[model samples]
Target: MITLFRSFFQSKLGIGITLAFLGLIALAFASSDVANTGTFGGVAGGETVAEVGGTSIDTAELRSTVETAYNNERSQNPDLTMTQFIEEGGLERVLDVLIQGAALVEYGEKHGIVISKRLIDSEIASDSNFAGLDGNFSEAAYASALRQIGLSDSMYRARLRQSLVANQLLAPAFIGSAFSENMAVRYAGALRETRKGKVVSLPSALFAPDKDPTKKQLDEFYASNRDRFTIPERRVIRYVEFDASSLKDIPAPTAAEIRARYERDADQYRASESRSLTQLIAPTEQGAKAILAKVRNGQSLAAAAEGTGLSPSDLETERADYAEASNAAVAKAAFEAARGKTVGPLRSPLGWHIVTVDAINSTPARSLADVRDEIVATLAEEKKREAVNQFAEDVEDGFASGSTLAEVASELGAEVKRTGPALSDGRIYNTPDSVPEILNPVLSTVAVMEEDSDPILAEVVPGEKFLIFDVAEFTSAAPPPIADVKEQVTAAWRLERGSVAAKAAADKIMKAVRGGKDLDAALRSLEKKLPPIEMVDIPRSALTANSERVPPPIALMFVMAKDTIKKLAAPLNVGWFVVQLDDIVPADTKRDDPEVATFRTNLGRGAGQEYAEQIDNAIEAEIGVTRNENAIRAVIEQLSGSGR
Candidate 1:
């Protein structure tokens, strides 16, 4: 699947360039802009990675950007390593983005594009990382976040200015651009082309070593493919939780306060009568009488109103309130009506009211003593909530004042607990181990947090429950000792050996078929009985029509030259395939074909991206990008800890 997408991205469309632009912009916005001046092991801080015109990108800057990108990727892919990240073009992509950004900035300056300080300030203020509890920008939070990342305010602003400049320069090129009709038609025609092929599979198991590998051989295999056996970084989380019940000594509501609360809402305790009415107001008295007559004749008030293109609504209101809203006469009629009875076509400012008394509720007035107990309970709850909030704030302040998790836990009389090592995605590192459900919310929080840094207080159930936690033990990602995974390593070794033999066999089969022997005859010529050759007929459009993964053998046949046979290795050391392309059929498509219009529309959407790429390329060419290969390599090595 990865190969299929890679092939498409690398094709004539060059979709990867557009994707690179988008991904880089997202990374630029998300990445911490702190320029770390710290040395990376043996690599000097000032070493140049690349120079765009007269601007130099130092090793420190590159390391920080690559590290941020690696960390971002690692959060989603917990097992990802710096080495794997670099291998998968992480280094090149980040370096290319850096170079492009520098080029854009330099070119923008020459062309009078200016990114204002106000814009950069707005960007910084809008970042959620610097937001406070009130959900607004906080200067203290911004400063604290910068301090944690070792990025000074000035450095962050400068880096932000560059990104803003680049966006200003490229955004215009991304609009109002499109591919030509001829180019669109040609692309559409290519999609309609078809190919016929034959594929023979040579299974690795057929050539695998029957005997077990020696201990030395197993060790060597484990050493070479250590990444396969390595585990993702995991941490033991330590935390203490507390809620409202934990805050003791909350003052009970006093008699005076309860009395005051009762007096404040004295009107609620007064005698009153309210009617629940479903009514419809008509345009005239005759219409109201017609509706009332229908209600009397077995139809519901709502049903009767429906005939007049109107609907009856239900509302419960006190007599005085209803009178004020309508008129005294209408209210008197509704209030006088018995429960489940329909009342008159009474006149009001809102035409005439045909009302149904759905229900009539009566209340008797009460003295202050009657609701005093209820008021006390309400006031007590309010006091407890306020105390709980203050307690939480005090705990946070304690941590902010250099207090440890254990110290805060001791003060609160809460037990500090340690969880089994867990991954960023909240899975137990040891499959058999488990932690209490209460700790789940904090696993992701502590995953990216530095070990032994300040503990954080997180709410588990909003205002009701909370947790204060920190990383107690941190383990870096690396392969375990060979002895622990000997059996698994031995199996892998056998598969690797088998795959090599299978590839050799596939080569022979390819040669036989290319030299005029039939595919089945060639397969029969091999010593081992292989899987039978399967013939495939596929349309080029079919490869991408449903967005499904095309089998590697079929995918390989599509890209192969007609009348040629080639050996292609299957993924995961599964087997080897001998693919023979029998014929290629050019698409017989007209200029007015529906597919042509479809492709034109699709390609037109990406025209702006092509324009942006061209603009970027032109800018780089004009500005002259000079890379220091040795320095770049050193920076990657330092980030991967290989230099150490």
Candidate 2:
């Protein structure tokens, strides 16, 4: 069975991933010979994915790694099945991952990096995922887990050691240098303060006909800044997008077809002896007996489940197939004893348990006749999906040959919707007040396109239907004649005049206030907020939008000498604001301020992240990633071959 996996791994995706896995566990595990792996379990000696110099990684081990991942996934998703997991490229994906790990481990050894055994133990000990109810790594729990996967500590440790060594080889490049202290202070200050300023805004709609600018002025502005108005170069394109939803029903699996499948794969529908069990445990042997007595005397399960202490009953419950004895400790004892039987006072690690079998629900495998309809429906949906994909492609092809969006939509029964010519800055498409964030990025792509292009595939919500757009025409942007924007130009001119006026007004008020003129009296003629003198702490990311804010300029006024007096400037966005920075807060060394400390720490981490990114770029460049994107479509096409 392990040998059957060879052809897939022989490919780069497979071999590369497999090598990574070997590289992870190669050091102490000694990949001497590849072991045979099967869906049922692992056995020694099988075909190898690769040999790290003299070391070999077994096919069985590769399968086991996949099984571990499967089990881990199922732990989160109770609805997932092993069979479904296998079919969704889950098994192949797992093998590739393991191989990559092996390769990394091999790479480390070839480079002379070493991972100590103590480090491997520390990793296991620190893994909260593997901890017991006591929040500690229980040896018994660990052993039980390994037993289910047919791995000994020695085997598991070997892999862990190799993984660490490989990581060690890579970590230095990722953390090339320590962060500077100067960066930390700057970062901390930026995060700890917010700039406060008053603003005056110019509404484009406010420009009136009387104030409209001349065509000469408008043309001069347009001519001088042509690049701002120029649209990006775009290509007209046509492409067929293939996705699971693009197709419709799978192949037509008729009654006979369904029957044949069900007959051939009846074992797939078999039901196992799964049990839902509850347990009551106590500390000492005598305490176990006492707890069993209490449970027998009708103590509540909740009371039995209280925290670790004397007279406390530790309650444990798990759901698992009866044969998987490790998933439920006490249930195994009860199942062995008999249905409706009160078993021990069983002697297990945490304490003793009073176990009872509430009910025995035995199930048998489904006969082919029972699930035939289901099999047919499943096969049909798959074929339908494939057909849908084919139809979409046909529609795209027709449009590419000079058909319109309406024509394509009419043929494929796809809906047609239109949005504005959104810009690439993501502003017009996705304003804070209008349009969706998802739509912005897609619309931005559409914004610059000049082509009678392919239907744009817009990302909808995750794992949901996508939106496709076909461009019919593009309205290339050209500067409108000033006559066309007469009203707008007039309004803009008024605001420009108001801005200059406001600065003069603010200057007079500020000087009078500073010269001991009544502060409230000085504000009489201005439309500014009165002195509540409020303050706020906001990060640098929140403060700056484009350029200089009033906070710094205002702060400068406080310590300004006689020669440097100038009128206060008003902000461009809102009502009149006067800024005054009262104090300069230094970075406090208080340990209680985790926010400050964490900001500093993140700056350090940012340096490492930058280095890691650089190394990733170098590796990718070295590897020369060639994407035959057409091949991807070919593979998907082959899988969705049955266009029902």
Candidate 3:
């Protein structure tokens, strides 16, 4: 059901419909009735961020909305930072959505568009989130879910009421919309258009200087881009890890314990009956009967199947248990048939099948001795995990009671480990070996912590160990002497010079092509210095920005006038390419084409949404909308946890 819902939501028309109310739904789930304490016309109340018509949008509500939006984004991308969230305009987006919803609600109230209490109650009662084990609405479950998110019953209902009213007001605009077939045909034709072109790449390696860079040239390059050579702040982290694998005192499981476990889970060790089956599906009942008769008369099954004109793959030979077979009738016949016996001309949903049981496999239960060692190892690991968890708790308690990491390690009789100075990006200086797996948590912890702060506890290896670490010393970012980075500077200088030359060559080729010369002819002029040119007919859908056959700038071809030449430098230090548009093939726009229908439906929904937005804007203008800029900025800072 969830998969079905997602498929519906992803359809072309469904996408536009969802966009119309997606923000409203998000705001509804994130909002509460904190604004209800003040009257609709009140001038003073709790801190307010905005006013729609005469109603105030409280600061508390806006903060909750931002936090919810941030959490939703982070749930999709776990590594997203608060700084990145703000930089992506998460706060402004949420505010605009909430404000738009507010405007819709105000307009609804003025026009007397209201949802009944019974309707709201029915909607809440049918919600799956409020359903209990018996699949009935449970008040306790409903209250608990709302409480977990800091929403009261009245607050939740108010948001729902607003959503219902807005839906009612917008339904007319969406339902009354229509799109023409001509418009759909035109749009789909543009999307399915294919372009045939040739690309000639100018490799930068061909333009490399024969000699190494002079000292003066290297020094000059380093002087101009010294900031690029500056190293970020590095930290030396000292830590002690409590590892489960280091527990040596756990006792092995006895024979009796192993036997008891085997008995408790005996069904898991039992194997189902399986058969090796080779089946030949016939196209007709008469053909199947003929094949079966041939097999029964001592002809080989493969030979009989070949007479029916079925390939080896079409025969579908493999091993399967009763449940694993393609259909129930085939499974039952295969299991019941004697080994080396041929059975069927049985009609399944697919076709008439004739099967031969080549082999039958039966598994017998084993004695406890067969798995004694595995059980013993499992018991030992469980004991070790418990011991490690206890030690981790003790270390955490020690830190809480004012003991340093070193002191805690001493108390536990564990050795403290120190890492070499490492940059914030996790690079260690002058180290021959890579960073140990266990030290990853320590590096991440110290990267964000203030210098000389208290030791922090973290799970370095989930379910196996914990690390207590602190930054022992810190080194701020600074540029090293040019002599120290001379090798790197020389490589950078060469790459820069090579890239410039490649672009210059590509530009010359582009100029020639624009002057009526063929692409191959233009490249042949520089044949000694260029690689072989490859041409491919790329459909518009296949011309993605990340295509391996074409550079990202190939997207420019669609926008350029036909028969024009263009040049683009490749990303990531690759060479440049000169591209020319040859011809375009537009899609067929027959009435029966599925793409045309989809495009028509999508365009209609898009037009409806545009009309809806215009309605919202006109409503806002009719009843003035004012916002408190200072309050909004303060709320943003608070949600980001950088409040001054």
Candidate 4:
């Protein structure tokens, strides 16, 4: 049966049909039932963790998958630790993916969806992972890749066969799904509907008291919300940087070496002449000669080409090398023509041409004495880079041997830079403008470290420099005394009281509007002074209009029924808003829109995905699945070093 299935697909669809299975198996595990718990009753540790039908997912398989994922992530983030990976739920994600793949494979077997060995071979042969330097399948390369990931050839082939079967089972679910035009129109109408409404904002500034808060009131506010005034943990770092720019006392180059370099690059130093030509091509030699006669008689190229019905762009007018001219004949005439001379009724591939030499530019080569300083500076910079690289290597070796940055700096005759206490947000207590560029990269690397971590060496700018740094002092987060920030506390207290007053006023206005009062009249009755009420049409999507003035209110207007009023807090802490839903304009059903077609295609895809998930869930439930906690815990401990 498997052989018959492969023969049918090969004769009907060829390589294209096999290529479609490339990502289908991965998609089966894209969403998983691993998040749903099953009764933990099965084999012991280091054995099978779960079973779908007759297929078993053992501890060894789960461990291999987790280790592969961890190594891949570690390649990009060298600092990632096993403890951190386990804490972030990486193990659970891999377990879910493995279980999901096993479930699909079981379903395919029951449904009699056979995938032949030949199909699996074809897929593996086409995979670039198994290809050699010459771009052909190599058995040795395939064996090496599997060995690196700790997979035997038979195990790898079995996994590939399972994926092919899973693809065969799930492909039919979405391949033929379609959505109707009416369904698309209805969905688009809801998204395209617009509402006209009026909004009134009660500004908090209007409700502020005339006088500042008393000390007693400020103290009470600060004591109750002390956490708001707390500063986060900060650090003071000290480091020494070794870079090319710090290299000094470089030796000067000799005159003999400078002259030798100039002679070696003699061709590059030689100059060539270029001419700007305005040319018009004609169909025949007689027509070209006639145009050349007119241009020689004081007619401009533009006026002469008017009869040819060609624009100025078609008549080439740019500078080019003599070798780059239109043809051999045109090249000879263009170089020989004197400045402002008209020449050429020359014939070639692009017909006959009438040419004019507009201008000639000439450049002379510079003598060795003229460029001596430039050559010397270039050589000095090259030497400086080499010296800096050697010095950085020495610094790294010293740091590895438990030497302090100060000791390294003393030996190398370099100065050490120290930073004042600064928050993680790059805010310093003092000397804001003097923040060194080296501090940022060092701080980012150490941000994940514990307080007072050991000094380490890091490359700040790749191929440029390295920094040796350690946390000099660390300060945990703590609230400042009220006396230290009394003015700031007083301002915050006033805003809190004003927000209360503004909310009450906005609610009153909304109450009036809901009770049949006009929107404009409700704003006039408010106790606090408010902004002018403006009525504008706002679309649900708001793709075209600038709705920044009252974005939250506009968003609420669409969800509310017509003739309803709601009050909301203003965005960005401005104040409060009273909004009324005046009217709604549904999308026009009679007109055909291009966006509606796009909407239909997207909806069809979503419906197909939901259907596929339902099918997988049904199959999984029917087959029954059981997971063993002991085996799972054992695999997690082995891979992540975490027992839980």
Question: In angstroms, how far off is 95's CA in candidate 3?
Answer: 2.4
lDDT of 2 at 502: 57
Which number leads on TM-score?
1
Which run of 10 residues does model 3 get worst, by summed lDDT?
1-10
lDDT of 2 by residue, 471-555 (tens): 4445443445556555654455545555555555666766876687754576665554444543433334444445666364445
Q: Candidate 1, after superposition: displacement of residue 321 in Å?
A: 46
Two-way lDDT contest, 2 vs 4, winner: 4
| Top candidate by lDDT | 1
Model 3 over residues 569-591: C-alpha lDDT tens digits?
77644578777778877877676
Tell me the deviation in Å of residue 129 in model 2.
Answer: 26
Model 1: colliding residue pairs? none
For candidate 4, give the lDDT of residue 489. Answer: 80
Model 3 segments beyond 4 Å from truth? Answer: 1-14, 19-49, 58-64, 74-88, 200-505, 521-534, 541-551, 568-577, 587-598, 630-644
Output the lDDT of residue 216, model 2: 80
| Better by lDDT, candidate 3 or 1 | 1
Candidate 3 versus truth, CA RMSD in Å, comes to 15.3
| Clashes within 3 Å, all models in order | 0, 58, 0, 0
* lDDT over C-alpha atoms for residue 481 of model 1: 90
As for TM-score, the candidate ahead, 3 or 4, is: 3
lDDT of 4 by residue, 149-224 (tens): 3355766677787666655655445442446777878888887888887777777767666688888888888988
Candidate 2, residue 19: Cα displacement in angstroms equals 20
